[model samples]
Target: MHKKETNLSHSKLANNMMNYINKNIDTDINIDAIAVEYGLSKFHFHRIFKEQIGKNIYETIKSIRLQKASNLLITNKYSTITEIASMCGYSSQTSFIRAFKNRFEQTPTLWRNGGYKEYSNNILHNSISSDVSHTSFSHLEAKIIKTKRKKLYYIRHQGYNKELSKVWQKMMAWVYTNNIENYEQIAIYHDNPIITLQEDCHYIACVKVDDKTKLTNTNLPYFEIEEHLCAAFEVEGIYGDILKFIQWVYHYWLPSSGFETTTFPSFSVFEKNHFLNDDGIFKVIYYVPVRYV
Candidate 1:
C-alpha cells in the first residue's frame, strides 16, 4: 500500500477501536478480544494503538469509563453508589470507588455533591458574556441542509465549567504546544444542559482532522460526527448565548418552520474571532438535526 492508504487505514482502525470502547463502556473489555475483532494480533494492535492514540488501549478505556461515570453521577440518574458502580461495570462498589478516586482524587460521593467544582467551574451555568437581545436573525442567513461526516479530535470536559474562556485557553495552548494550527476548532456539547442537571452536562473542546493528521500524539479523545439533515441558522452572539440561540431555534424557529428535531444532537460551527474574542461576541452557524414533518 502507498503511504497515504497506510495512514488512512491506521486512522480507521484507531477510530474503530475508540467506538468499540465507548459502546462497551459498561462491560468488562478484553484486549485480546478487541484485537481479534479488529483482525490484528494482540501484540501488534497494542503497539499501534498506543502509538496512534497516545495511551494504552486499556488506559484509554478506563479514562472513558470514568468520564462516563462522572456524567452519570452529576446527572443523578442512578440513586445509589452500588448502582452506579455496577452500571460502570465494576464488580464491587469498593473497587469502583478506589479506581474513581485514583483517577479523580475524590470519592464518588464527594465528586457528586458539588465537589466537582475543584476541578471544574460552573462557567456554563446561567452566564452570558454578551447580550443578544438587540441581535437580529433576519440579517443572518439560515436554511435546512445535510452535513457530511467529520472526524473530531477533542479534550473531554466534565461538570458545569465548560466556560469557553478556560476551555479555549487550554485548547489553544495545546495547539501551540503541539504546533497543529492547521486544524479546525469546534466545540461539541455531549448533553443538553437545559434538561440535564447542571453538573451532568458534558462538553469537548475540539478540532477537526483527517487521516493525515496524527491523533494519539495530540493526547485528546477523538470521535466521528455522523452526517445529518439539519435546520441550520447563522447567528452572532456571546459564546455563552449559544444555548439561548439554540432555545430560540428549537422553541420558536423550528416549530414555525414546519420541521421537527431528529434524534441527533445539535452543534455549532464558529467563525474567526467569534469564540473567545476580545468583544465577547461570536459569529456562529448552528445546526439542529431535523426532519421535515
Candidate 2:
C-alpha cells in the first residue's frame, strides 16, 4: 500500500478501537479480542495503535475510564461511590478508589465534595476564579426533552479554542464537495474543560448524515448518538461562554434540577457556529443527556 493509504488505514483502526472502548467501558475489554476483531496479531496491533494514537491501547482505555469517573463524581452526586465505581467498570470499590486516587490524587468522596476544584484550577493555571460564577445561566431555563438517534460523519479535533475554526472550515469543504445539503452541524464535547486541560480536551466536529447522503467516497469516521433524555438549552454566546455554560449545567442546574447526568457526552446542535463566524458568536441548542436521580 502507498504511505498515505497506510497512514489512513492506521488512523481508521485507532478511531474504531477508541469508539469500541468507550461504548463498552463498563465491561471487560480483552486486548486479545480487540486484536482478533481487527484481524491483526496482538503485537502488531499494539505497535500500530501506539504509533498512530501516541498512546498504548491500555493507556488510552485507562485514561478514558478515569476521565469518565471524574465527570461522574462531579455530575452524578446522588450516586454512591460504589455505584460510580461499578459504572466505570471497576469490579471492587477498593480497586476503584485506588485507581481514582492515582489519576486524580483524591478519593472519590473528596472529589465529589469539591476536591475537583483544586485539580481543575491547577490544570487551568487557576483561571477558575471565584468571580467566574454560575449566575450566567440563571436567566436561561432548560427544557426537558427526548432526542432522536443521529448518525454523524465527523473529524476529531483535540483542544478547544478559536483554532477550531480551521476544523469547521475543512468539514464544510467536505460537506459542499459531497453535495450534502440537508444536515445539522454538531459538536461533541468529550471532556469536561473544567477538569481536563484546555489544550487536551477532545472535541469532535460532526455533520449529521441521513440515508440520502452519499458517503461512499469519504474516509471520515462515523459514530451514532443514541436517543437520550436530555435537558436542552438554547444558547447564544461568544467564544468562551459555552464552556462556562457547561460548567453551570453540571455544577449548578443539574444538582438543583433533581437529575443526574448519564455517561454520554453532552453535544450542541449549531444554528450558527461560533467557530465559523468572524464575530465569534454562536447560536446553539445544547443538549445534556440526563436521567432522574
Candidate 3:
C-alpha cells in the first residue's frame, strides 16, 4: 500500500478502538484485546496510541472512569459514592476520593452537593446505563490551524495510579497552611511532558496561583501555551479512547489536511461539562502547529 493508504488503514483501526472503548465504558474494558484485534502487540499499540493521541491506555481508562463517576454523582437518583466508585472500577473509597479530587478539585460529597455549575444540566442529568456497543463515529474529521497563545500555571507530577493525589494533597495542604490561594477558580494544568507527550503521561496539574505568592520547587516550571498555528480535531465518545482518536488525527488527518506541521506540541482545551459524561458529546479543541502548506 502507498503511504497515504497505510495512514488511512491506521486511522480506521484507531477509530475501531475508540468505538470499542465507548461500547465498553461501563464494563471492564480490556486494552489487550484491543491490541490483539488490531494485530498489534500491547507495546506497539501503546506507542502508536501515544504518538497519535498524546496519552496512553491507562490515562484513557481513568478519564472514562472519572467521567462516568461524575455522571453518576449528579444523575443517579440513588447511587452512593461507594457504589459509584466500585462500578467505575475503583478498588476502594479512599482511592475513589483521591481520583475524584484530582480530576475535579472536590470530594465526592462536595461535588454531589454542589451539582456542578460549570457543566450543562443535561450532562448532569444524562442517563448512565446506555450501551455504546452499537454507536458509530466514522464520519469525524481532523483539521489543522493557528491559534492565539494561552498563559497558564502548571505543576509537574509523576507516579503510578492516583499518585498525583499526593502531589495535590501536598499542594492544597500547603496552600491552606500558608494561606496561599483558593483552588475554586483554578484549573490544574497537566504539564508533565511524558503524560502530555505520549503513553503513560504524567500530570502537571496546575491551578492559577496568585502572582504574589511565593514559590518553591513544588510550585513551578509554570509556563505559557505559545501562540501558533494548531491542528484541531474532535475526539468523540469516552475520553479513555481519546488517545487512538488523537493518533488518527496526527498520523492520518494532518497529512490529508494539507497543513504543514510546526514545532509546538499539541494541547487539548476542555469546554464546559466536557468531562462529565461517559459517552458524552464533548468537543476537545486540540492545537497543533502549522507551517506553510
Report the number of the highest-TM-score candidate. 2
Candidate 2 lDDT, 204-264, residue by residue in tens:
8999867777764587878787899999999987777788788788777887788888778
Q: Estimate candidate 1's alpha-carbon lDDT, on a 0 to 1 scale.
A: 0.65
Tens digits of lDDT, candidate 3, 1-293: 99766655655555445435543555667789868877889998887766545567688778757765664565443557897787777878998899989987778888777534433323223313221223433477556565655544544444222354466555556556656653321222222221122223434444445556665533233444456766566654553344444434444455455554432335566452223334445455555555554
Ranking by lDDT: 2, 1, 3
lDDT of 1 by residue, 1-293 (tens): 99867766776677567667765667888889878987899989988877666778888777666765665565432247787676666778888899999977899899878566545434234444223233445454568799998887765555444355687787777777766757777766645553334445556567776567553355555678778897777777655466655545544465456555533456777785344677866776778776654
Task: Identify the leading candidate in terms of lDDT.
Answer: 2
Query: CA lDDT of 86 in candidate 3?
Result: 74
Task: State each model's CA lDDT, in order.
Answer: 0.65, 0.84, 0.52
Please report the TM-score between candidate 2 and the true structure.
Answer: 0.93
TM-scores, each model vs. reference: 0.53, 0.93, 0.39
Candidate 3: stretches off by over 4 Å: 118-293
Worst 10 residues of 2 by lDDT: 126-135
